[model samples]
Target: MHRTQYLNSVNDFIDWFASNLGHASLFAHSYIDRRSNPAAPRTLAFTTLFDACKQYHWKHNGAFGSPAGACLQTNDAALSALRQALQSAINTVNDSKTLTASSAVMSWGGVRAGNVRWLTANSKGLAQTIASVCAALDSDNLSHPVLTSCQPLRFNAGMTKVYSLLVNDFIIYDSRVAAALGWIVVKYCQARKLPAVPRDLAFPWAPAKEAANARLPKNRDPGLGNYHFPRLISGELHAVWNLKAGWILAEVLARASHNPFRNSSTVPALRQLEAALFMVGYDLPLNVSPSGVNSEPESYAEGDWTECYTAARGKLFHYRVEEGGIRLLDGRFYPVAVINRMLIILVELFGTDPFPLANSATKVRVTPSIPGIGYAYFQATDERGNPPSASALAAVLHELGVLNYTPDNRAPWALDFGDYVQRGRIDLEALLKLESERHDDVGELIA
Candidate 1:
């Protein structure tokens, strides 16, 4: 394959593998309500890992696409095999056992944000082995000192399968590895009687710094082997750029709103916009602590909680219902069932029928895919099904039937607020007034 094409394919496969791996673990853990307006934990995890991995890979080599390919192909066998391991781990983590959130470890290390030494020590060696295999795949850096480590070994499968298998393996193993590490840390804590730290359902790796990205660490000591896989136990950003654009869209649509009931295009358009947010890219929160570090937090608001929000700020997500399917901007895709999942979420958040839109009344076909970078589109169509119209959406909702619009059922998503704030009700008008008065960044943008 041409170098550029080869790199693109590799990256694409990586993206797919990352999202799948993260999602598999997350979906197994909890059924999230997207409409609650909370972020997708799995999706955030995927983007975080991808960026970190990309950054790490790029560090040894200058650029990712071409320069990195040379490094990857040299030791293709190791890389390929490792990828397969990661994929297997991802699948196994979800299907093997029942993993509860309370018992989960969100990050393998301590409470500190940059504690990747534990992760790197375990996986960095693997990257080196893979890099050795990939050294011959590219023309540019074949002469580099790193290439000297490259020992050509014959491979069995086609390049694509080999690559896919390797990616899958690494991801699966990555989970196992991290969990193992977490166990070790926990043990150490228990040995000394350290208090247990809480982890999110899906354990997340830390984000990459702007100056240097993170890379997989080499296996430091085989003694850590006991930590790899427990026979089956399983688990598992900022940006205002899109906010400005979305506000612009919302304003444009608001202008078209005619009757007090609804506008011709605005409601669906906003729904589409909401769907697109899932597709947009964002950073994720990660928890990590190095061995020998002080793991306890001296203050309440400083550590992991702070990290979580920082990651939230880095995510710029977008979703839109276009031609019937939900599209995401971050190159990951989901089925229309995912769309309904999202709509159900929003219905709960803003109250059912907050807009003129309704669920589709007929059987539907859903396929979600991202054909290019920076976005994913989901296409939903009726199978002789229902006429594809705004009303059809409502029809489907009616057929499926229950809408989650009650208080007792909505507590998992509730945030603390005074009577003035109104817990369950999302007062958009009041919010707008607050924004207008504050005249902050969001207000300025929306205004």
Candidate 2:
């Protein structure tokens, strides 16, 4: 796509998605509301959404499934695992006196898996590089060659993580986003009759021989060597391209926010812009799933049994059977009969009788019972009995609907619960009272 067209498409999609934000039930509206809140910490907001994207991808693409096509035992189960992984990552950097610096290093270290120890060993040097690059980016000094200082840490993915963690100024650079930028830049150059930036610069994994030949020294280009484009030149080019892309995206979103046809109350957040670019880069489906219902089955049975839960009216209504087909309670037939047929085949293929139960001793279990529907529970707990840090706790509370949140037009609740928790606030009796009240409410509904 042309640069203008690409920008327009991304902006248009962001507008459309923003207007229909509530459709993705799993991405609670509170998360979106927090993203636009200036008071919310940027690192926490971005990381939460980033984590959500990973789960969203796994849920939709069957990424957690085994090679034999067996699905995850349950959506909640898979989400729990994802959350645990995130909490483990959070635990690694939770005590940093300077969260932004710690987050940048940890995020960089994460992408460079085998080099984490090395990265950690040279934390001071990595910190310097991150600080310099982030400073240069903020000042729009794309010509400063910031990546040159990042010597051993040359991977674009890690560098992008550093950039993303430092500020909301740059988009994460991956192969897909890189390709989208390349297409835009190439078209822009073509239209203007300017020299095209080399494609090998954008996609560094071009075959070694081809890359070598492309960078061969010429009489007109004496400083150039075979490895110049991939090693040095490409990094410089990427820095320039990233700056341009960021500005273009910001401009597009800014215009969209003010567009007369747009109906969203707030401008798109940087994370939302990144997500829009990601979708455009990967050519992902723009439409949110119909009603945000999880289509995956929770359980299945082989001989004379089947089990599953269907989401309806904001609740997961359960079903089970000891026969040929699922039997919905109260003679509640599936709205889509074809889906039921597909579930039978899925059940036969992936069913493992007696689904695994979560271990209760190690997890904080929250089970809520809906009237006339079955019980649903989720288990999570902080690592090492440590209270979650401010950001981590915010994410958890947001997920649990316990956080102070309001939609676009309303003022957010003013609460110092996070501060109180940090100060070792402990009201065991009050907590017990609250729990008792909650149980009483559930009991009333059940009765």
Q: Total backbone clashes of model 1?
A: 92
lDDT of 1 by residue, 120-165 (tens): 2223243343334334322322233433334433221112122223
Clashes of each: 92, 0
Q: Pairs clashing in candidate 2?
A: none
Give a tens-digit lDDT track for model 2, residues 1-447. Answer: 233544453453335433333333322211122112446533212232223333221111111231211122332233233334333433353322222233323322222221232233344444454455666677655445554465532434445544654444566554334433333333333434545344422322111111112221101110111111122123555555565566555554454433322332132354444543342233211112235532321111111111222111112233322122223443433222222222232233223221111223323223322111011011112222221112222221222122222222122212223211222332223322332222111110000
Candidate 1 wrongly placed segments (more than 4 Å): 1-131, 134-180, 192-324, 328-447
Q: What TM-score would each prediction reach against the true structure?
A: 0.18, 0.33
The TM-score measured for candidate 2 stands at 0.33
Tell me the lDDT of model 1 at 369: 20
Q: What are the lDDT figures for the candidates, one per model?
A: 0.24, 0.31
Q: Which residue ranges in model 2 land beyond 4 Å of their true spot? A: 1-112, 145-155, 183-235, 256-268, 283-447
lDDT of 2 at 223: 11
